[model samples]
Target: MLTRTRMLAVLLSGLCWTQGAWAQGSPTGPAVVATIKPLQFIAQAILDGEGSVSALIEGSDSPHHFNLSPNDRLRIEQADVLLWIDPKFEVYLAALFADTAASESSLMVTASAISGLTLHRYPDGELDPHLWLSQGNALLIAQALTEQLACIYPDKAPHFRAGLDQFRSGIDKQAQALQRRFSNQHVADYLVYHDAYRYFEHDYGLTHSASLVADPDIQPGMREVLELRETISASSPACILLEPDASPALVNTMVQNDAVKRITIDLLGNSLESSANAYRQLIDHVATGFLSCLNI
Candidate 1:
């Protein structure tokens, strides 16, 4: 059974595709607009030399807290095919999609709208939207975006599909490389400041013992903190993970203990545009972070 959030996502995605089915625009050239940087990168890579693709959020900033700059608004208005993740994570995107539903030059693809988009929650019921952290899920996302682009711009369908095939193949090779690289190291269990990266950990058979269910927002009382301390003491995990902006308390715990390794992993490309500009590099960074902790 789908949860209410998922059900709403399904309804919104239906509306997204239904608008296209009913009204196919006759634009000559393709100018795709993506909501996030990673989505933009994948679309551009697929339409390499075939179309014009760009992103509204090109900064190494959190899309969850993204404010539309003047350039962002301009790009959104000019985009022909807009690809984005679930708007539940981005309020501006949700409102923008609602307003542009009647427009002919706009299309939005949400990651939560597709199959194989795994939804996870903490034991307390908070959602994790960081699906792009895992290489496997990233491949699925890339495939969906490529297919949608091909469908919308059939004039370049052949070119798009060929590029997609190559990209997917390359991604597969990278996945294999990740697996082989970490197979013997066996850094299965690591502590995270936030409850993200299940997809990446699951793909690599690693265990994510997250310190917080929700990042930056996690409010653990004294009891929870004490319990977490015990868990860390027992596990003695090879590394403790922290994000630059997440949980100061949890990170301080590790620093105080001096019992585990410390690794800073960034979900938003290290809060920089270059390191996390693509899916493959993001996955690589995660895998490398894990292996680096194991002293592998």
Candidate 2:
């Protein structure tokens, strides 16, 4: 079976070929490129009828360690506006940005740059780059991308602004509802396969007891595994969250004989079709996972 990433690559390649042929004789808006699916989804929302958006890395691969191909690099160079979370999250993109002449076209929306965000830092004092996990950050993403699109196609500023306002309204209601849903639940502590939900947790006032891996690409050492095992055994958390893109074997090995319930959460919206409401659906999907796991 072709993975989603490969499938998207083939589809986008075909589309690019078709679009390239058409562009030879027609005037078109600048191409928008994003580093991942979530960013692509947000960009798509703002660009709707104005232009198309493409993602460099697709499928289940973690952005933390993705290796860009020649085509991917070409997309970046050709993009009129490039959006990514930050180099801390997509570490490989940092060098790519520096090496390529596309620096002037790229925007890094880190937590610090965005106002009204509750940022977190790792023990090493590095900022958490998972800003998209929080609803507030999602709003920030939509606003930032709207500004980019407006600049690129100033004639469509009204369209972009209207879309941004609609998105803001929809997400505001959903965020309030999600907060109510999680707040009503009594399960304050839970376990996760990866430490990717701290932003969400912080936003919702949920507490994570332990994580199987701090970095998705790095497996837990034996000592760390034992510690997590002990923590789970001691707390017997009501729910253990796993990333849909991660290996189920890792979650199984961690849980072993524990009676805890397991739930899969997809933060990247990989399974969702890109649209204006894709981010909202992604948030709802994650909320459903938490609600199902907590039985609230």
Candidate 3:
């Protein structure tokens, strides 16, 4: 027969061993990293607490000119899954992903290449990578994310599927609400600082009369400015949609008429906190901005 102290020690050892085994067997999901906040928002919805999601480009930084730092590189290297729009838009990430060594260990998702998404092109024939603006495209993205994540962590496939369903339902509800809101009001013609809202506008049946510039980095010249001003004066558009970072002076130059309203549309979700519903909030906020200006 064992002594009381010996029996107690043996029981404690067995308990510790069992705990260790359980810990080792527990399923811990992947660490996903997105190239931008909008992508991160979509990923967060699908991940839905099954894993971690983070954005590489935060705040007002434009991916067009974003350069990765040592920390950023480390984050990408350590991530189990990486998400980005495409090489054309996120030009900085193209070369990094091209390296076989860099891409070998992780799942890299080029959202633009995902099938079932309705993609668009710029007037210059370049692919428009802002597909997330459309709730439909967002659904497709969520589905793709679910499938990719499921492949990596099959044990959490059910949770990911549930997340995708929830995301689709949330988008459908929000889109219906927005459609009702727009149907009850008159949305007048508008102009945008750049042609970035094509997906949003197409989804809502709203069209801009003109744009100040094709690319935000390239400011309109004197002739282009005069033409835009003439167009604004002639058509009397209800509003001029300026981005959060648009130049006030340029806007003033383009819109000398005080009757033309100016509304700041943040497509980047700059002011939003990171959450599962952030993508929906972004769409709602954008619609609200348009309604505030276009309703006259």
**Candidate maximizing lDDT:** 3
Clashing pairs in 2: none
Question: Model 2, range 1-296, lDDT digits (tens) per residue?
Answer: 32324323432332221222212311477477788887787777777766678878777777876878888888777666557776667778877664442233333333235445568888878887777778787777677667645544566779989988888898889988887887765774678877777788787887778888887877878888777777777777888888876677777767775568888888888888888888888888887887887788
- Which tens-of-lDDT digit does each residue in 76-127 have in candidate 3? 7767667888878888887775452233455567788776789989867888
By TM-score, rank the candidates, best first.
Answer: 3, 2, 1
Candidate 3 global TM-score: 0.88
- Give the Å shift of residue 221 in candidate 1: 3.6
Residue 104 accuracy (lDDT) in model 3: 44
Ranking by lDDT: 3, 2, 1
TM-score, prediction 1: 0.80
lDDT of each: 0.65, 0.70, 0.78
Q: Native-vs-model 2 lDDT?
A: 0.70
For residue 140, model 3's alpha carbon misses the true position, in angstroms, by 0.5
lDDT of 1: 0.65
Worst 10 residues of 1 by lDDT: 14-23
Worst 10 residues of 3 by lDDT: 14-23
